[model samples]
Target chain A: MIQYDKISSRDAFGNALLRIAEENPLLVGIGADTTKSMGMQKLSEKYPERVINIGIAEQNMTAVAAGMAATGFQVYAASYAPFSTLRAAEQVRTFIAYPNLDVKIVGGLGGLSGNIEGVTHQGLEDVAVMRSIPNMTVVIPADAASTEVITEEIARIRGPVYLRLGRGAVEKVFDAGYRFQIGKANVLKADGSDAAIICNGAVVARALRAAQLLDANGVKARVIEMPCVKPIDADAVVESAAATGAVITVEEHNIIGGLGSAVAEVLGGRRPSPLLRIGIEDIFTESAPHNDLLDRYGFRPEDMAARIGQFLSSFNSKNEEEA
Target chain B: MIMKSSVAELREAARLIRRDIIDIAYLAEGPSHPGPALSIADILAALYFRVMDADPRNPGWAERDRLVLSKGHACPAVYAALAGRGYFDRAWLTTVRRLGSRLQGHPDMNKTPGIDITSGSLGNGLSLGLGIALALRLLRKNCGVFVILGDGELQEGMIWEAVMAASAQKADNLTAIVDYNHFQSCGGTDEIVPLEPMRAKWESFNWNVFEINGHDMEEIVSRLEMAKRFTGRPTVIIAHTVKGKGVSFMEADNSWHQRIPSKEQYDTAMRELAGGSE
Candidate 1:
């Protein structure tokens, strides 16, 4: 059993932004009538003038943030995930990504964490949209600790970044002193050789627990945490796939375009390993409790463990038949 | 710093920019939009020559005013003005839209030295300008931002969002110049989308509205300067202009909106623009 702390990545990021603003006078925040809901309440309270609530206009907020970035301000444009990515899609691509502005596009309530709000609010396809845009650095921190570190790290990056954050208190994957770097994946558990569990965002800790369960069942699996979705750790992915001979990618997003596609792009005929992708399988999710949604979507620890176990058992059976 | 030029000098500058536009169109390996470019030449001449305080030597001067060419297709006009104002060499103007040239079909702030924001996608430029104005105000920097808009571009929903937000924030340091050339890529804005009651619309939105002849060099300069003094709300100058102002065959013609001039047409335009001040 692993100890877990519930910390919302959005809150951690907001707190880190407030702390960062203390020294950097040019830091500006743009909100789409979500200053409080998006975790910028504390920052707004402390420095009310720094945050501009654009009042439910996500597209305008994005371009406004891009404009602010042109003036040398490290800017953050925060809105709900669906509206930020889908509704304001062209603005992000045209104003920020094409220009390579230093504007950080923050989307709160990523994935099933916006479960109670249903498909309208959830960001099941944000990573896909963001990854497809040129010059966009996509990041989804595993937990609050990683989120805090990533927020600080990406602030120093003088280019466009999309930092997706979840709504609920996510199960903490890293401890207090976790170090993070953009485009690098961290291996949490390396004692396994049967297969590797590569995941990002809040699902990282669940992947670790699934790995632990795999260990108990005499099936060893490696757990790798991939935070940066774009500029991915292709070297780690190739090596891990080559070492374990199999790869399973877990994300809180659509399996079609998120971590799975990224990994597949990296392993395109080079590794030639069997790949299994687990996520919200290209369907709209109904409103429910966050954990129930996770469970239904096959993101729970036992669900992943069972699925990986079945897949491995089938692979072994095929190999035995070949032998 | 502001270039202190007389009205005659500014008119001469506008003619030169118009000539530059014709030159680029003639040099084009493909078709280009010379209609919108021709309309905004005088306005760009007024801003770069006498009204706006910007430095060609230091394009990134923190204190200098910035221009967001919101209607980015009119960049041929902007490139002409920037070249005339010494942002870059006049040689690059001939290389417009050419492969590997810094003068792209649209304005790119990174590739080009003096472009404040990369704009071409309409209805987003005003917000970009508002953002810069708000930022400069926060830093207590005495600066202004000019956003050049197309009348048809006003039909975009995001433009109204920026318009309302700018007034609500009381962004007095921001100015938006609508090149009301009465035409867009397709047809006349009045006939197509019809942004009529235009003045009342902006006034209702609480902007300091000023109507001017966009082709008038002195009126353009004075209205731009007055925008800086007008406080408590953002200023918008709606300048009425012709689609293609100078040449006889192109004036008020929708056919010329996005058409690159043919060799004979280019020679005719150069001749007309050369014999200026009618």
Candidate 2:
């Protein structure tokens, strides 16, 4: 369990990176003019010598970070999710991932975290682009505590990693003393489940809330928080599917290639189940409040609760009809 | 003058590199731009054999000088020099673009040894080299970075983007050489993109510019030696040479950009390459 005040994922990344930088002098923080946006400014201020502010060149910044990593420096290149994952993808592919350089790419405002920044700012396609690259560890933290913990974990591990952190405040999912294994999924609520709600990133909190709402309506729902999207815990996913017979994956990214897509891929090829993937459709986002955007994109807790109710009702009707 | 023995060995290495180019192209049935490679044969030989401090056994030496072959299609020459320097088994030079060979049609850094950056896409090498130069400078490493850009490749907008950044950063430890072979794959560079006043263009970008006859061993080595002594800004060596220097039928022929020879033509080319005794 992480013993810290509830904070946003981006803020947690900021706080956690500062702690790691204290011990590792080789750890350098670089931002493509998004230090404050990604909450890397804290790390910058704490370790001024280690932080490199590369004005506004995202492409140059990525290549520069890769070069630094090649020369035996642990580099964390920070920027918004869309820009870091897509805008500088070629650089990440050629310099960082292909060469297997030690670059920790911290992408902030994943999914619709930057609600008001509109569709352009939303990173619905970030996971799709990053997960395709070989030797890349794709991580989407469920909340601030996990984000901080994962940031510390990747700093110790070598190779390229893409850590997605959300903007804005999020509810805490894990309690104090919860150990976060990098590629392991945390089963938040298990047993006595009518359906399983599997989610990642900050959307896990919403899934948890929806589970609570389902319990209030006489439906037991198990909420699972899957942080590592690339090397997904298939055992956890299969166990949830086996226990509940139906699974719902919630996330703030695009349904095409985000957490839902990853889960569907595992579930489709392995033990198949009736899986509902809740996320942004294949559409661009525009500037709006983060919460309002979440609501509009059908990712709010209420939306998730409604979806669970529909799945449970349908499952019950099918069971009764069989009887 | 200072490193007499090394320079003499490099000259012999240059002759071998020239011979390897003729042999590799003939074996693969792949016609490369021979003039550019023949002209740059001495420089490549000097760098790999004498000037650049590298480890063939340990290609990943941190302090080794970085080389980016911006004109990657000229790998026939580069592969020859790399083999001459013992970066890989010299026999591997015969499998230039064969299946499962480390050598690709273009240089792949992952597959090939001593290739600092993967570059087949023109206009990307300088930027990649710039990244390496900047990274080394940031780490306070005292190693030199070298990039060889083709004259035709200079037409790419990314090259200028890199030029502006290199100049702005004042990367003194980096040196860029333009293989001014006067011809591109299509035709003469002037007829294609018209890059006249090449030296002035580099100078305007705040680079220290030098022009030399690329094939002349003395000028090529002297300019490279001078580049080390001068500092405060990056240096660009614009080496002028004919397109296909050694073979009479292929000399100044743009058709040889990638045109392989017939059996008889191959024999003739070999004869011409071996001082035309046949």
Candidate 3:
């Protein structure tokens, strides 16, 4: 039995920020009245001079962060995913991205993590919105450990970055010793590729379990963890597709412009292969428990395993017909 | 210490800057916001020529006071002042809106030296200024951030948000100047959206409000000095002036807000600004 230590990505992000602040005194934190929720309260308390709560004004907060960046301060602005990535998107695009300021935007409660709050709070389309902006680096950590790694990495990078964090605790996908690199996908499990399950954010662990389930069913599936969605690892994607001959992309976001779309864009242009996107269709999610919502959206490990199996079976039959 | 320039000297600098504005507008291909630019010539003159601690040769000096032209469409005024102050060659002023020119239609800090922030979009300057003020405070730098906002830009909600935060933080190092020409694009400010109770608005937000005749060089200099002295809160200088103050035909006319002057109109403007053709 695998021992799983679970912690919220928000807590990991907050802890990482506190650690980062101790080393870099020039680092400043700005919040849009979401200090506690976005895991920035400890930083605000410890470094009161460095942390600024700009009330509920996300737009002003974003611009202020940019202004701080212009003055040579490494700034991180945090807010709810919807508010930060959508409400203040124009500010992010104009002030931070256009000027290419070194501002890191921390988006909390991405996707169905805010499931209990319904569509209003759920950040279903944040990835799509942020990925479209020029000069923006979009990162979604798979678990608490990766969240810490990603937080530290983005702070070191000298440009605009969007770090998406989940609301609740999730099973650990990587150990503390796991090396994190920007724009590189981590392969969690690899075997003879009947199919490859590419996933990111809160769904990576599930994809791993789905791969195990596929193994028991006599199908060898590879699990690839894509943390950086914008500067996507195109080589890893193409290699996985070429080796497996089938690809399944899973994300806790809309299927349109999330990791699935990013992977499709890479493979569709460079290498053609059978691909299946596993994510929320074009629709709003209703209020429910987080796990239940994941299940309802066909994102549970069992569902992923079943879907990948079906896709592989069809893929094999098609190949057989061609042969 | 406040730098001083005689009213006559400041007046001459303002007139020269106005001529430069017209010259640049004439050279540009499309319409530029010359009326608003001409309106603030004296204010810019008082700032660049007298008040501001900036060196044109060293535009990126760390201790230098920063200026954010929030009312960005009126960049002709800033561009001309920068040129007159020797931040760049005066010859480059002719390429205002030309392709690949550092002098973009609006201010871009990365592209242009001496521009502190990129601000063509209205209502973003004050917030950006506040950020710089906070940064200065954090670094213990004794520098001030001056933001020039358009009167019509007051309609944007983000401006008020920034206004509230600057006072709440007690950012004494920041000063916001409103170029209240009483006009915006399309019509008079009253017909569009009145900002008449502007003094009360800033005061209510906990800012130190100073009302002055923007065209008067003396008032512009003194008020800016006063704002620098007042500590523990941000200041807002409401400079009342006529739109297109230098030119007779363009003065107080909203249609001239963004209209490029014809050859005859440009000649008349230059002649009037050059002290009635010698």
Candidate 4:
């Protein structure tokens, strides 16, 4: 068993931002009254001049970020995922993405992380909305370690990027030495030729655990972490499908227009494999504890393991029947 | 403030910009917001030719004053002004909205010279301008950001949010000019949704409010200059204007908001703009 340190992705993002801002004076942080929640409070406190709190207005905050970007300021604006990607979506699309401005949008509390806040606060559809915009690079880091690396990488990259961060603490999936790239998938564990589990965001650690469970049951599973969903790692996805023959996608987002859809788009053209998507069925989540919501939505490690095992068995039986 | 040119010369420039606006609209052979575009001819002329500190030779000079046409449909007027000020070749005006033309129906900063920001969606420019103002202040760059908004665009809730933010931040380097043409796509602003008490509303937001006749080149220039001198708060110059100022048939007529001129109407408008007999 790997000893996992627990930390929230939002906290990692905040620390990474502060470190980057210290090196680059041109980097400005803007928040829509979500400084504390989005992990910008420390940056705000340290560099009071660089951080702007645009007070509860996501639309204006996005536009302001774009305006600053046009003047050659590397700007990052943060808010709750739903508000950042949906409420201010038009601003993000028009001012930032349309012009391909260098404004990094950090969406905290992505997926069901905003637990107990009910449907409005939860950001289950952020990936769907953000991925649809042209010139928008959508990134969902799997754990706190990767989130820090992703934040540093996005700050170095120029153009519009949507970085989705989770609210709750998650087990560290990557080591401190893990190098982050924008459009590459990180393969965590590859053992079995029976099935492959592709995952991202908060569910990646669970997917790894599921793969472990599958391995013990004599069904070897390959686990791939796809951090960047928009410019998805098509090469990795195709290779995994060709090797494993069956695929299961795990995410904390809606099954539509997310990791599953991205993988399907890749494989439907390149390689045809029986794929099962494990995520929230297209529906809003109710108020509950974050862990309970994760389990109920089929994001738990055991649940994902069981589903992948069932899929592998059915896929193998179908192949044998065809033979 | 020193006047570079006589008010009569500025009036001639405004007249020429109006003429160019009609010419571009006719050549584009597509829908154009002529009413709103014509309405802001004098304002655009004053800003481009007189009030703004910009170099036509070097359009991207770091210290140059910036303008964001929040009401992007009125781009023809800005295009004409940019050409008139020699930001680009005068012949480019004929290619407005043509296939692969730099002058898109709306302002695109990357494609067009002298355009600082891409603005088409309403209620975004003020916030964008506020952001630019903030950056300029932080960089210690002595430049001002001017954003032109349509009165009808005030209907968007985001505009109020920007208004509140601009005031709360005390963006003294920012100035917003509203072309109070009084007409929207559907009908008059009052008929659609009342925006009266507009002056009081701006004042309540802690903005320095200046009301002027948008068509009067002198008033436009003087007020814009006054805004530059006024420090401590951002300024909003409410320039009351007719929907279509020069063309008699289209003036105050909301039907012409997005109307492309027929040959007869176009000829009549060109003649009237040329100070010819009707």
All candidates: interface RMSD: 0.7, 2.8, 0.8, 0.6
Q: In DockQ, how does model 4 score against the reference complex?
A: 0.86
Considering every candidate listed, which one attains the maximal DockQ? 4
Report DockQ per prediction, comma-separated: 0.84, 0.38, 0.77, 0.86
The regions of model 4 sitting more than 4 angstroms off are A1-6, B1-3, B275-278
lDDT of each residue in A1-323, candidate 2, tens digit only: 21333677888888888899888877888777777777777877776757766667677677767766766778899998888988889878877888788898988888888788777777889998998899898998877777778888888788999998877877677644556776789888886467888888776777777788778888888888888887889888888988988889898888898788888988998889888888887778778887678778887777788877897788679889999
Clashing pairs in 1: none
| Residue-level lDDT tens digits of model 4 in B1-278 | 33466678788889989988888767677577888899999998888888888888888889888999999999999999999888899899888888889999899999999999999888788988988988898889989899999999999999889899988898889999999988988888998998999999999999999999999887999999999777989999999999889989989988888877889888998999995333
Better of 1 and 2 by DockQ: 1
lDDT of 3 by residue, B1-278 (tens): 53567888899999999998898878784578888899899999988888778877788887888898988999999999999888889888988888889999889888888898777688898989899899889999998888999999999999999999999899999999999998988788888999979999999999999999999988999999899778989999999988999899999987888887889999999889876339
TM-score of each: 0.97, 0.89, 0.96, 0.97
> Per-residue lDDT tens digits of candidate 2, residues B38-64?
657877887777667778888898888
Q: Which stretches of candidate 2 lie over 4 Å from their true place?
A: A1-8, A42-49, A174-178, A315-323, B1-11, B29-39, B155-161, B182-201, B241-245, B275-278
Candidate 4 pairs with clashing backbones: none
Better model by DockQ, 2 or 3?
3
Cα deviation at A187, candidate 4, in Å, is: 0.8
Query: Candidate 1 lDDT, tens digit per residue, A241-306?
Result: 989988999999999899999999998856777788999888988999888898888988898999
Better of 3 and 4 by TM-score: 4
